[model samples]
Target: MTVTLKDFYADWCGPCKTQDPILEDIQEDWGDRFQVEKVNVDEEQDVANEYQVRSLPTLIVENDDGVVERFVGVTQREDIEGALESAGA
Candidate 1:
């Protein structure tokens, strides 16, 4: 069961800008263990809608077991890591 972290954001979103590097660092730390994909809301509205994203920087973590968790706004690295741990990564 592969886990996926979908990052929903837009270029003009200030908070999303702040969130980018954090997710990047997390992605690097997790390596292949985490399938992190950046979803630009402006470019992928349907995908955002699929996850019911109502804000920028919304992260939807999903896997074969289903949606493990969701985080909105500026998320802490520890929290995201904890979700990874919960996903058995």
Candidate 2:
């Protein structure tokens, strides 16, 4: 199973900026266990709309099955790690 982390964000979103470093740390720790796809809501409105992202810094953890976890706003590292693990990353 391929676990993926879809990060919905916008350049002007403060919370999204806070979330960036957290995700970078996860990428460093997890390595190739999962893939991270960053979507700029302002540039990719269609993609954001498809996911129904109503807020900045929306994170979605998905695997082959489907979406396993979703987070809104700034999320903790541990919480994201837990979601990744659950998604078989």
lDDT of 2: 0.95
Report the C-alpha lDDT of model 1 over 16-78, residue by residue, as the tens digit: 989888888988878899798889989999988888999878988878898898999999989
Q: Which candidate ranks first by TM-score, i.e. highest?
A: 2
lDDT for each candidate structure? 0.87, 0.95
lDDT of 2 by residue, 1-89 (tens): 99999999988899898999999999998899999999999999999999999988899999999999999989999999999999998
**Against the true structure, candidate 1 has what lDDT?**
0.87
Q: Kindly report which residue stretches of model 2 are placed more than 4 angstroms away from their true locations once superposed.
A: none
Mark the regions of model 1 whose C-alpha exceeds 4 Å error after superposition. none
Worst 10 residues of 1 by lDDT: 80-89
Q: Quote model 2's TM-score.
A: 0.98
Alpha-carbon shift of residue 1 in model 1 (angstroms):
2.0
